[model samples]
Target: MKKKWVHIIIISVVFLYLFLPLAATFLYSIAKEWHNTILPVSYTFSAYENLYTDPRFLQAVGRTLLISGITLVLSVVTMATATFVVFMYLPKMERVLQALVMIPFAVPGVVAAVGLIKVYSSGPIILSGTIWILIGAYYVLVLPYMYQGIRNNLRTIDAKRLMEAAEVLGASKIKGFAFVIMPNMVTGILLSALLSFSILIGEFVLANFLIGGYYETIQVYLMRRLNENGHLASSIVITYFLTVAAISWMMLRLGRRFGKTEEIKEKIS
Candidate 1:
Protein backbone atom coordinates (compact mmCIF):
# COMPACT_ATOMS: atom_id res chain seq x y z
CA MET A 1 0.00 0.00 0.00
CA LYS A 2 2.81 2.38 0.82
CA LYS A 3 4.60 1.63 -2.45
CA LYS A 4 1.37 2.09 -4.41
CA TRP A 5 0.76 5.45 -2.80
CA VAL A 6 4.32 6.51 -3.61
CA HIS A 7 3.82 5.57 -7.23
CA ILE A 8 0.56 7.50 -7.33
CA ILE A 9 2.27 10.56 -5.96
CA ILE A 10 5.02 10.34 -8.56
CA ILE A 11 2.50 9.97 -11.36
CA SER A 12 0.51 12.91 -10.08
CA VAL A 13 3.63 15.08 -10.08
CA VAL A 14 4.47 14.10 -13.65
CA PHE A 15 0.91 14.69 -14.81
CA LEU A 16 0.87 18.15 -13.31
CA TYR A 17 4.28 18.89 -14.82
CA LEU A 18 2.91 18.11 -18.25
CA PHE A 19 -0.62 19.46 -17.92
CA LEU A 20 -0.11 22.75 -16.07
CA PRO A 21 1.42 24.55 -19.01
CA LEU A 22 -1.48 23.53 -21.20
CA ALA A 23 -3.93 24.66 -18.56
CA ALA A 24 -2.16 27.96 -18.22
CA THR A 25 -2.22 28.49 -21.97
CA PHE A 26 -5.92 27.70 -22.14
CA LEU A 27 -6.66 30.20 -19.41
CA TYR A 28 -4.53 32.84 -21.07
CA SER A 29 -6.40 32.44 -24.32
CA ILE A 30 -9.68 33.37 -22.70
CA ALA A 31 -8.26 36.00 -20.40
CA LYS A 32 -9.17 39.60 -21.09
CA GLU A 33 -7.26 40.98 -18.14
CA TRP A 34 -4.84 38.81 -16.21
CA HIS A 35 -2.18 41.20 -15.05
CA ASN A 36 -0.52 40.21 -11.76
CA THR A 37 -3.35 37.91 -10.82
CA ILE A 38 -3.59 34.28 -9.82
CA LEU A 39 -6.37 33.98 -12.39
CA PRO A 40 -7.83 36.28 -14.99
CA VAL A 41 -9.73 39.24 -13.61
CA SER A 42 -12.03 39.04 -16.59
CA TYR A 43 -12.41 36.53 -19.40
CA THR A 44 -13.55 36.83 -23.00
CA PHE A 45 -13.76 34.64 -26.06
CA SER A 46 -12.44 37.36 -28.32
CA ALA A 47 -9.15 35.58 -28.94
CA TYR A 48 -10.92 32.54 -30.36
CA GLU A 49 -13.38 34.79 -32.15
CA ASN A 50 -10.56 36.69 -33.77
CA LEU A 51 -8.87 33.44 -34.73
CA TYR A 52 -12.00 32.05 -36.33
CA THR A 53 -12.64 35.25 -38.21
CA ASP A 54 -9.26 35.10 -39.94
CA PRO A 55 -9.42 33.62 -43.45
CA ARG A 56 -5.72 32.90 -43.50
CA PHE A 57 -6.06 30.66 -40.43
CA LEU A 58 -8.63 28.52 -42.19
CA GLN A 59 -6.51 28.30 -45.36
CA ALA A 60 -3.49 27.35 -43.33
CA VAL A 61 -5.46 24.66 -41.56
CA GLY A 62 -6.75 23.27 -44.87
CA ARG A 63 -3.28 23.20 -46.41
CA THR A 64 -1.85 21.50 -43.33
CA LEU A 65 -4.58 18.87 -43.42
CA LEU A 66 -4.02 18.29 -47.12
CA ILE A 67 -0.29 17.80 -46.65
CA SER A 68 -0.78 15.52 -43.65
CA GLY A 69 -3.37 13.36 -45.41
CA ILE A 70 -1.25 12.89 -48.54
CA THR A 71 1.87 12.16 -46.53
CA LEU A 72 0.04 9.71 -44.27
CA VAL A 73 -1.33 7.79 -47.24
CA LEU A 74 2.01 7.70 -49.04
CA SER A 75 3.96 6.66 -45.94
CA VAL A 76 1.51 3.95 -44.89
CA VAL A 77 1.28 2.33 -48.32
CA THR A 78 5.00 2.47 -49.06
CA MET A 79 6.23 1.44 -45.63
CA ALA A 80 3.66 -1.32 -45.14
CA THR A 81 4.36 -2.94 -48.51
CA ALA A 82 8.12 -2.58 -48.17
CA THR A 83 8.12 -3.97 -44.64
CA PHE A 84 5.97 -6.92 -45.69
CA VAL A 85 8.27 -7.74 -48.61
CA VAL A 86 11.34 -7.43 -46.43
CA PHE A 87 9.99 -9.65 -43.65
CA MET A 88 8.59 -12.29 -45.99
CA TYR A 89 11.22 -12.80 -48.71
CA LEU A 90 14.22 -10.60 -48.03
CA PRO A 91 14.76 -11.32 -44.34
CA LYS A 92 18.44 -10.53 -44.67
CA MET A 93 17.60 -7.06 -45.98
CA GLU A 94 15.68 -6.11 -42.82
CA ARG A 95 18.87 -4.95 -41.15
CA VAL A 96 19.70 -2.72 -44.11
CA LEU A 97 16.21 -1.25 -44.19
CA GLN A 98 16.31 -0.56 -40.45
CA ALA A 99 19.59 1.27 -40.78
CA LEU A 100 18.22 3.40 -43.60
CA VAL A 101 15.15 4.38 -41.59
CA MET A 102 17.26 5.36 -38.58
CA ILE A 103 19.26 7.79 -40.66
CA PRO A 104 16.43 10.37 -40.44
CA PHE A 105 16.66 10.32 -36.66
CA ALA A 106 20.35 11.25 -36.75
CA VAL A 107 19.80 14.04 -39.25
CA PRO A 108 18.19 17.17 -37.83
CA GLY A 109 15.25 18.72 -39.67
CA VAL A 110 17.11 21.96 -40.52
CA VAL A 111 20.04 20.15 -42.09
CA ALA A 112 17.72 17.89 -44.06
CA ALA A 113 15.70 20.86 -45.25
CA VAL A 114 18.79 22.72 -46.40
CA GLY A 115 20.14 19.67 -48.21
CA LEU A 116 16.81 19.08 -49.88
CA ILE A 117 16.64 22.68 -51.01
CA LYS A 118 20.14 22.59 -52.46
CA VAL A 119 19.42 19.45 -54.44
CA TYR A 120 15.94 20.39 -55.64
CA SER A 121 16.35 24.15 -56.13
CA SER A 122 18.29 23.77 -59.36
CA GLY A 123 17.50 20.20 -60.35
CA PRO A 124 15.87 19.27 -63.63
CA ILE A 125 12.83 18.31 -61.61
CA ILE A 126 12.86 21.21 -59.17
CA LEU A 127 10.57 20.70 -56.18
CA SER A 128 11.75 23.56 -54.02
CA GLY A 129 9.02 25.87 -52.66
CA THR A 130 6.26 23.52 -53.79
CA ILE A 131 3.65 21.64 -51.76
CA TRP A 132 5.03 18.45 -53.28
CA ILE A 133 8.36 19.14 -51.65
CA LEU A 134 6.72 19.50 -48.26
CA ILE A 135 4.81 16.29 -48.78
CA GLY A 136 7.97 14.46 -49.81
CA ALA A 137 9.85 15.77 -46.78
CA TYR A 138 7.02 14.76 -44.46
CA TYR A 139 7.02 11.28 -45.98
CA VAL A 140 10.69 10.88 -45.13
CA LEU A 141 10.18 12.34 -41.66
CA VAL A 142 7.49 9.82 -40.71
CA LEU A 143 9.21 6.73 -42.13
CA PRO A 144 10.55 5.39 -38.84
CA TYR A 145 7.19 5.60 -37.17
CA MET A 146 5.38 3.96 -40.07
CA TYR A 147 8.00 1.22 -40.52
CA GLN A 148 8.32 0.29 -36.84
CA GLY A 149 4.60 0.30 -36.18
CA ILE A 150 3.81 -1.91 -39.17
CA ARG A 151 6.78 -4.20 -38.46
CA ASN A 152 5.69 -4.72 -34.86
CA ASN A 153 2.14 -5.45 -35.95
CA LEU A 154 3.35 -7.99 -38.53
CA ARG A 155 5.47 -9.66 -35.85
CA THR A 156 2.62 -9.71 -33.33
CA ILE A 157 0.30 -11.33 -35.84
CA ASP A 158 2.97 -13.89 -36.81
CA ALA A 159 2.71 -12.90 -40.45
CA LYS A 160 5.06 -15.63 -41.70
CA ARG A 161 2.94 -18.42 -40.23
CA LEU A 162 -0.21 -16.87 -41.61
CA MET A 163 1.35 -16.64 -45.07
CA GLU A 164 2.51 -20.24 -44.87
CA ALA A 165 -0.97 -21.35 -43.86
CA ALA A 166 -2.42 -19.49 -46.79
CA GLU A 167 0.08 -21.14 -49.07
CA VAL A 168 -0.92 -24.59 -47.74
CA LEU A 169 -4.51 -23.73 -48.68
CA GLY A 170 -3.26 -22.90 -52.22
CA ALA A 171 -3.37 -19.16 -51.87
CA SER A 172 -0.70 -17.26 -53.79
CA LYS A 173 1.65 -14.94 -51.89
CA ILE A 174 0.06 -11.74 -53.18
CA LYS A 175 -3.45 -12.95 -52.43
CA GLY A 176 -2.42 -14.11 -48.95
CA PHE A 177 -0.80 -10.79 -48.22
CA ALA A 178 -3.72 -8.75 -49.47
CA PHE A 179 -6.55 -10.76 -47.92
CA VAL A 180 -4.92 -12.19 -44.79
CA ILE A 181 -1.92 -10.17 -43.60
CA MET A 182 -3.10 -6.69 -44.46
CA PRO A 183 -6.32 -6.84 -42.44
CA ASN A 184 -4.44 -7.73 -39.27
CA MET A 185 -2.20 -4.71 -39.79
CA VAL A 186 -5.02 -2.14 -39.85
CA THR A 187 -4.83 -1.24 -36.17
CA GLY A 188 -1.10 -0.55 -36.17
CA ILE A 189 -1.31 1.32 -39.44
CA LEU A 190 -4.05 3.57 -38.08
CA LEU A 191 -2.08 4.23 -34.91
CA SER A 192 1.07 5.07 -36.84
CA ALA A 193 -0.83 7.33 -39.23
CA LEU A 194 -2.38 9.18 -36.31
CA LEU A 195 1.03 9.71 -34.68
CA SER A 196 2.58 10.85 -37.94
CA PHE A 197 -0.31 13.20 -38.66
CA SER A 198 0.02 14.77 -35.24
CA ILE A 199 3.78 15.20 -35.65
CA LEU A 200 3.40 16.71 -39.09
CA ILE A 201 0.76 19.15 -37.91
CA GLY A 202 2.89 20.38 -35.02
CA GLU A 203 6.12 20.53 -36.99
CA PHE A 204 7.24 24.09 -37.75
CA VAL A 205 10.91 23.94 -38.60
CA LEU A 206 10.86 22.19 -41.96
CA ALA A 207 7.60 23.81 -42.97
CA ASN A 208 9.00 27.22 -42.16
CA PHE A 209 12.36 26.59 -43.80
CA LEU A 210 11.24 24.82 -46.95
CA ILE A 211 7.92 26.37 -47.89
CA GLY A 212 7.45 29.39 -45.59
CA GLY A 213 4.93 31.90 -46.89
CA TYR A 214 4.94 30.32 -50.32
CA TYR A 215 2.67 27.74 -48.72
CA GLU A 216 1.78 28.47 -45.15
CA THR A 217 0.83 25.57 -42.88
CA ILE A 218 -0.97 25.83 -39.56
CA GLN A 219 2.34 25.86 -37.72
CA VAL A 220 3.64 28.67 -39.86
CA TYR A 221 0.45 30.61 -39.31
CA LEU A 222 0.68 30.03 -35.58
CA MET A 223 4.23 31.39 -35.50
CA ARG A 224 3.11 34.52 -37.30
CA ARG A 225 0.23 34.95 -34.83
CA LEU A 226 2.59 34.47 -31.91
CA ASN A 227 4.49 37.63 -32.80
CA GLU A 228 1.29 39.61 -33.29
CA ASN A 229 -0.68 38.78 -30.13
CA GLY A 230 0.05 36.61 -27.13
CA HIS A 231 -3.59 35.79 -26.37
CA LEU A 232 -4.35 34.90 -29.96
CA ALA A 233 -1.29 32.71 -30.11
CA SER A 234 -2.44 30.99 -26.96
CA SER A 235 -5.81 30.44 -28.58
CA ILE A 236 -4.15 28.88 -31.61
CA VAL A 237 -2.20 26.54 -29.37
CA ILE A 238 -5.35 25.55 -27.46
CA THR A 239 -7.28 24.95 -30.67
CA TYR A 240 -4.44 22.91 -32.13
CA PHE A 241 -4.23 20.83 -28.96
CA LEU A 242 -7.96 20.11 -29.01
CA THR A 243 -7.92 19.26 -32.72
CA VAL A 244 -5.07 16.76 -32.31
CA ALA A 245 -6.60 15.32 -29.15
CA ALA A 246 -9.90 14.75 -30.93
CA ILE A 247 -8.16 13.05 -33.87
CA SER A 248 -6.08 10.86 -31.57
CA TRP A 249 -9.11 9.83 -29.56
CA MET A 250 -11.05 8.90 -32.68
CA MET A 251 -8.18 6.91 -34.19
CA LEU A 252 -7.46 5.06 -30.95
CA ARG A 253 -11.11 4.10 -30.70
CA LEU A 254 -10.97 2.75 -34.24
CA GLY A 255 -7.77 0.88 -33.47
CA ARG A 256 -9.37 -0.80 -30.43
CA ARG A 257 -12.40 -1.74 -32.50
CA PHE A 258 -10.19 -3.24 -35.20
CA GLY A 259 -8.19 -5.12 -32.58
CA LYS A 260 -11.34 -6.66 -31.17
CA THR A 261 -12.54 -7.67 -34.64
CA GLU A 262 -9.21 -9.33 -35.41
CA GLU A 263 -9.34 -11.22 -32.13
CA ILE A 264 -12.83 -12.52 -32.89
CA LYS A 265 -11.73 -13.61 -36.36
CA GLU A 266 -8.80 -15.52 -34.94
CA LYS A 267 -11.05 -17.26 -32.43
CA ILE A 268 -13.57 -18.19 -35.11
CA SER A 269 -10.91 -19.56 -37.44
Candidate 2:
Protein backbone atom coordinates (compact mmCIF):
# COMPACT_ATOMS: atom_id res chain seq x y z
CA MET A 1 0.00 0.00 0.00
CA LYS A 2 2.79 2.37 0.83
CA LYS A 3 4.60 1.57 -2.37
CA LYS A 4 1.33 1.94 -4.26
CA TRP A 5 0.94 5.54 -3.05
CA VAL A 6 4.51 6.29 -4.04
CA HIS A 7 3.88 4.91 -7.51
CA ILE A 8 0.63 6.83 -7.76
CA ILE A 9 2.28 10.05 -6.69
CA ILE A 10 5.16 9.58 -9.09
CA ILE A 11 2.81 8.78 -11.94
CA SER A 12 0.71 11.82 -11.12
CA VAL A 13 3.72 14.08 -11.17
CA VAL A 14 4.92 12.69 -14.48
CA PHE A 15 1.46 12.97 -15.98
CA LEU A 16 1.28 16.62 -14.94
CA TYR A 17 4.76 17.26 -16.21
CA LEU A 18 3.90 15.92 -19.68
CA PHE A 19 0.32 17.06 -20.09
CA LEU A 20 0.78 20.61 -18.79
CA PRO A 21 2.92 21.74 -21.72
CA LEU A 22 0.78 19.88 -24.24
CA ALA A 23 -2.39 21.29 -22.74
CA ALA A 24 -0.99 24.79 -22.69
CA THR A 25 0.01 24.52 -26.31
CA PHE A 26 -3.39 23.19 -27.29
CA LEU A 27 -5.17 25.95 -25.41
CA TYR A 28 -2.93 28.62 -26.83
CA SER A 29 -3.39 27.25 -30.33
CA ILE A 30 -7.14 27.82 -30.07
CA ALA A 31 -7.10 31.17 -28.30
CA LYS A 32 -7.77 34.34 -30.30
CA GLU A 33 -5.60 36.41 -27.97
CA TRP A 34 -3.57 35.55 -24.93
CA HIS A 35 -2.28 37.93 -22.28
CA ASN A 36 -2.01 38.26 -18.53
CA THR A 37 -5.78 38.27 -18.10
CA ILE A 38 -5.92 34.89 -16.37
CA LEU A 39 -7.44 33.34 -19.54
CA PRO A 40 -8.08 34.16 -23.18
CA VAL A 41 -11.75 35.14 -23.47
CA SER A 42 -12.14 33.41 -26.86
CA TYR A 43 -10.85 30.51 -28.99
CA THR A 44 -10.62 29.86 -32.73
CA PHE A 45 -9.24 27.49 -35.38
CA SER A 46 -7.90 30.40 -37.40
CA ALA A 47 -4.39 29.34 -36.60
CA TYR A 48 -4.93 25.79 -37.84
CA GLU A 49 -6.71 27.07 -40.96
CA ASN A 50 -3.92 29.50 -41.72
CA LEU A 51 -1.40 26.72 -41.26
CA TYR A 52 -3.10 24.49 -43.84
CA THR A 53 -3.53 27.27 -46.38
CA ASP A 54 0.01 28.55 -46.03
CA PRO A 55 2.48 27.37 -48.68
CA ARG A 56 5.26 27.31 -46.13
CA PHE A 57 3.37 24.81 -43.94
CA LEU A 58 2.72 22.51 -46.90
CA GLN A 59 6.34 22.64 -47.99
CA ALA A 60 7.52 22.09 -44.45
CA VAL A 61 5.27 19.02 -44.15
CA GLY A 62 6.71 17.53 -47.31
CA ARG A 63 10.27 18.22 -46.27
CA THR A 64 9.59 16.83 -42.81
CA LEU A 65 8.17 13.62 -44.28
CA LEU A 66 11.14 13.24 -46.60
CA ILE A 67 13.69 13.75 -43.83
CA SER A 68 11.82 11.52 -41.38
CA GLY A 69 11.54 8.66 -43.91
CA ILE A 70 15.26 8.77 -44.61
CA THR A 71 16.05 8.93 -40.92
CA LEU A 72 13.77 5.96 -40.12
CA VAL A 73 15.42 3.75 -42.74
CA LEU A 74 18.94 4.66 -41.59
CA SER A 75 18.10 4.24 -37.90
CA VAL A 76 16.54 0.83 -38.54
CA VAL A 77 19.51 -0.32 -40.58
CA THR A 78 22.04 0.89 -37.99
CA MET A 79 20.10 -0.46 -35.02
CA ALA A 80 19.51 -3.83 -36.70
CA THR A 81 23.19 -4.26 -37.61
CA ALA A 82 24.32 -3.13 -34.15
CA THR A 83 21.91 -5.53 -32.47
CA PHE A 84 23.05 -8.46 -34.59
CA VAL A 85 26.73 -7.80 -33.92
CA VAL A 86 26.45 -6.95 -30.24
CA PHE A 87 23.91 -9.56 -29.18
CA MET A 88 24.84 -12.56 -31.34
CA TYR A 89 28.60 -12.05 -31.53
CA LEU A 90 31.01 -9.81 -29.59
CA PRO A 91 31.49 -12.26 -26.75
CA LYS A 92 34.83 -10.74 -25.74
CA MET A 93 34.07 -7.10 -26.58
CA GLU A 94 30.37 -6.66 -25.84
CA ARG A 95 31.14 -4.00 -23.26
CA VAL A 96 33.35 -2.06 -25.64
CA LEU A 97 30.79 -2.32 -28.44
CA GLN A 98 27.94 -1.16 -26.20
CA ALA A 99 30.02 1.77 -24.99
CA LEU A 100 30.58 2.80 -28.59
CA VAL A 101 26.83 2.63 -29.18
CA MET A 102 26.34 5.19 -26.41
CA ILE A 103 28.82 7.65 -27.94
CA PRO A 104 26.16 9.67 -29.78
CA PHE A 105 24.43 10.49 -26.52
CA ALA A 106 27.63 11.11 -24.58
CA VAL A 107 28.93 13.64 -27.11
CA PRO A 108 27.06 16.93 -27.39
CA GLY A 109 24.88 17.19 -30.50
CA VAL A 110 26.55 20.38 -31.72
CA VAL A 111 30.03 18.93 -31.25
CA ALA A 112 29.12 15.75 -33.14
CA ALA A 113 27.60 17.73 -35.99
CA VAL A 114 30.65 19.96 -36.22
CA GLY A 115 32.94 16.89 -36.26
CA LEU A 116 30.83 15.20 -38.91
CA ILE A 117 30.75 18.35 -41.02
CA LYS A 118 34.53 18.55 -40.88
CA VAL A 119 34.99 14.84 -41.71
CA TYR A 120 32.53 14.89 -44.63
CA SER A 121 34.32 17.90 -46.10
CA SER A 122 37.76 16.28 -45.70
CA GLY A 123 36.71 12.83 -46.99
CA PRO A 124 35.97 11.89 -50.60
CA ILE A 125 32.25 11.58 -49.75
CA ILE A 126 31.91 15.34 -50.65
CA LEU A 127 28.55 15.52 -48.90
CA SER A 128 28.52 19.26 -48.31
CA GLY A 129 25.11 21.10 -48.49
CA THR A 130 23.02 18.00 -49.22
CA ILE A 131 20.21 15.79 -47.85
CA TRP A 132 22.85 13.18 -47.03
CA ILE A 133 24.23 15.41 -44.30
CA LEU A 134 20.77 15.81 -42.77
CA ILE A 135 20.23 12.05 -42.96
CA GLY A 136 23.63 11.40 -41.37
CA ALA A 137 22.85 13.88 -38.60
CA TYR A 138 19.50 12.15 -37.99
CA TYR A 139 21.31 8.79 -37.82
CA VAL A 140 23.29 10.01 -34.81
CA LEU A 141 20.56 12.00 -33.03
CA VAL A 142 18.13 9.08 -33.07
CA LEU A 143 20.74 6.51 -32.09
CA PRO A 144 20.40 6.59 -28.32
CA TYR A 145 16.65 6.02 -28.36
CA MET A 146 16.80 3.39 -31.11
CA TYR A 147 19.64 1.64 -29.32
CA GLN A 148 17.65 1.48 -26.10
CA GLY A 149 14.75 -0.18 -27.90
CA ILE A 150 16.99 -2.70 -29.69
CA ARG A 151 19.03 -3.43 -26.55
CA ASN A 152 15.94 -3.89 -24.40
CA ASN A 153 14.44 -6.32 -26.92
CA LEU A 154 17.78 -8.11 -27.03
CA ARG A 155 17.84 -8.43 -23.26
CA THR A 156 14.40 -10.07 -23.16
CA ILE A 157 15.41 -12.75 -25.66
CA ASP A 158 18.01 -15.36 -24.80
CA ALA A 159 20.01 -14.77 -27.99
CA LYS A 160 22.75 -17.24 -27.13
CA ARG A 161 20.36 -20.06 -26.24
CA LEU A 162 18.24 -19.44 -29.32
CA MET A 163 21.29 -19.33 -31.57
CA GLU A 164 22.61 -22.56 -30.06
CA ALA A 165 19.23 -24.25 -30.49
CA ALA A 166 19.06 -23.07 -34.11
CA GLU A 167 22.67 -23.95 -35.02
CA VAL A 168 22.23 -27.50 -33.80
CA LEU A 169 19.21 -27.75 -36.11
CA GLY A 170 21.40 -26.75 -39.11
CA ALA A 171 20.36 -23.08 -39.47
CA SER A 172 22.98 -20.46 -40.23
CA LYS A 173 23.47 -17.49 -37.90
CA ILE A 174 22.03 -15.06 -40.44
CA LYS A 175 18.96 -17.20 -41.10
CA GLY A 176 18.30 -17.90 -37.42
CA PHE A 177 18.88 -14.34 -36.36
CA ALA A 178 16.66 -12.91 -39.08
CA PHE A 179 13.83 -15.47 -38.83
CA VAL A 180 13.73 -15.92 -35.03
CA ILE A 181 15.20 -12.95 -33.23
CA MET A 182 13.76 -10.32 -35.55
CA PRO A 183 10.16 -11.37 -34.93
CA ASN A 184 10.61 -11.00 -31.17
CA MET A 185 11.99 -7.50 -31.61
CA VAL A 186 8.99 -6.14 -33.49
CA THR A 187 8.01 -3.89 -30.59
CA GLY A 188 11.53 -2.61 -30.34
CA ILE A 189 11.63 -1.84 -34.04
CA LEU A 190 8.31 -0.06 -33.83
CA LEU A 191 9.49 1.93 -30.84
CA SER A 192 12.67 2.89 -32.65
CA ALA A 193 10.66 3.93 -35.68
CA LEU A 194 8.35 6.09 -33.61
CA LEU A 195 11.20 7.80 -31.81
CA SER A 196 13.33 8.18 -34.92
CA PHE A 197 10.40 9.60 -36.83
CA SER A 198 9.64 12.09 -34.08
CA ILE A 199 13.22 13.23 -33.72
CA LEU A 200 13.82 13.56 -37.45
CA ILE A 201 10.62 15.42 -38.27
CA GLY A 202 11.22 18.09 -35.63
CA GLU A 203 15.01 18.33 -35.55
CA PHE A 204 16.15 21.95 -35.73
CA VAL A 205 19.58 22.74 -34.33
CA LEU A 206 21.66 20.41 -36.51
CA ALA A 207 19.46 20.79 -39.57
CA ASN A 208 19.79 24.54 -39.33
CA PHE A 209 23.57 24.57 -39.02
CA LEU A 210 24.68 21.58 -41.14
CA ILE A 211 22.05 21.74 -43.89
CA GLY A 212 22.89 24.86 -45.87
CA GLY A 213 19.53 25.76 -47.57
CA TYR A 214 19.38 22.63 -49.75
CA TYR A 215 16.71 20.77 -47.76
CA GLU A 216 14.73 22.68 -45.16
CA THR A 217 13.40 20.28 -42.54
CA ILE A 218 10.08 21.21 -40.86
CA GLN A 219 11.64 22.39 -37.61
CA VAL A 220 14.06 24.61 -39.47
CA TYR A 221 11.27 26.08 -41.57
CA LEU A 222 9.14 26.72 -38.52
CA MET A 223 11.96 28.42 -36.67
CA ARG A 224 12.57 30.73 -39.63
CA ARG A 225 9.01 32.15 -39.57
CA LEU A 226 8.33 31.97 -35.82
CA ASN A 227 9.43 35.53 -35.07
CA GLU A 228 7.15 36.99 -37.76
CA ASN A 229 4.26 34.51 -37.91
CA GLY A 230 2.54 33.12 -34.86
CA HIS A 231 -0.31 31.44 -36.73
CA LEU A 232 1.95 29.52 -39.06
CA ALA A 233 4.08 28.35 -36.14
CA SER A 234 1.02 27.12 -34.24
CA SER A 235 -0.16 25.32 -37.33
CA ILE A 236 3.18 23.51 -37.57
CA VAL A 237 2.90 22.42 -33.95
CA ILE A 238 -0.64 21.07 -34.46
CA THR A 239 0.26 19.28 -37.65
CA TYR A 240 3.38 17.76 -36.07
CA PHE A 241 1.30 16.51 -33.17
CA LEU A 242 -1.08 14.81 -35.56
CA THR A 243 1.82 13.11 -37.30
CA VAL A 244 3.26 11.97 -34.00
CA ALA A 245 -0.12 10.58 -32.94
CA ALA A 246 -0.55 8.59 -36.13
CA ILE A 247 2.95 7.10 -36.02
CA SER A 248 2.66 6.26 -32.32
CA TRP A 249 -0.72 4.60 -32.85
CA MET A 250 0.70 2.43 -35.62
CA MET A 251 3.63 1.40 -33.39
CA LEU A 252 1.27 0.58 -30.56
CA ARG A 253 -0.83 -1.57 -32.88
CA LEU A 254 2.25 -3.42 -34.11
CA GLY A 255 3.48 -3.90 -30.55
CA ARG A 256 0.12 -5.21 -29.35
CA ARG A 257 -0.06 -7.62 -32.30
CA PHE A 258 3.12 -9.25 -31.01
CA GLY A 259 3.40 -10.57 -27.44
CA LYS A 260 3.10 -7.20 -25.70
CA THR A 261 0.86 -8.85 -23.14
CA GLU A 262 1.65 -6.42 -20.38
CA GLU A 263 0.73 -3.38 -22.49
CA ILE A 264 -2.46 -5.07 -23.66
CA LYS A 265 -3.41 -5.99 -20.10
CA GLU A 266 -2.85 -2.43 -18.97
CA LYS A 267 -5.06 -1.10 -21.77
CA ILE A 268 -7.78 -3.61 -20.93
CA SER A 269 -7.65 -2.99 -17.23
lDDT, each prediction: 0.91, 0.75
Q: Where is model 2 poorest over a 10-residue stretch in terms of lDDT?
A: 257-266
Where does candidate 1 clash, by residue pair?
none
Which portions of model 2 miss their true places by more than 4 Å?
Answer: 1-24, 32-43, 241-269
- Looking at model 1, residue 101 earns an lDDT score of 89
Location of the lowest summed lDDT over 10 successive residues in candidate 1 = 260-269
Which digits, one per residue and each the tens of the lDDT, describe model 1 over residues 1-269? Answer: 99999999999999999999999999999999999989999999999999998999999989999999999988988899999999989999999999988977999999999999999999698999899999988998999989998887887688899999999999999999988999888888988888888889989889999999999899999998888988998998899889889988987897787677668757856
lDDT of 2 by residue, 99-142 (tens): 76688778877887788788888677977688788787777778
What TM-score would you give candidate 2 relative to the actual structure?
0.77
Model 2 residue 181 CA deviation (Å) reads 2.0
Any runs in candidate 1 off by more than 4 Å, and if so which? Answer: 1-5, 247-269
Q: Give per-model TM-scores.
A: 0.89, 0.77
lDDT of 1: 0.91
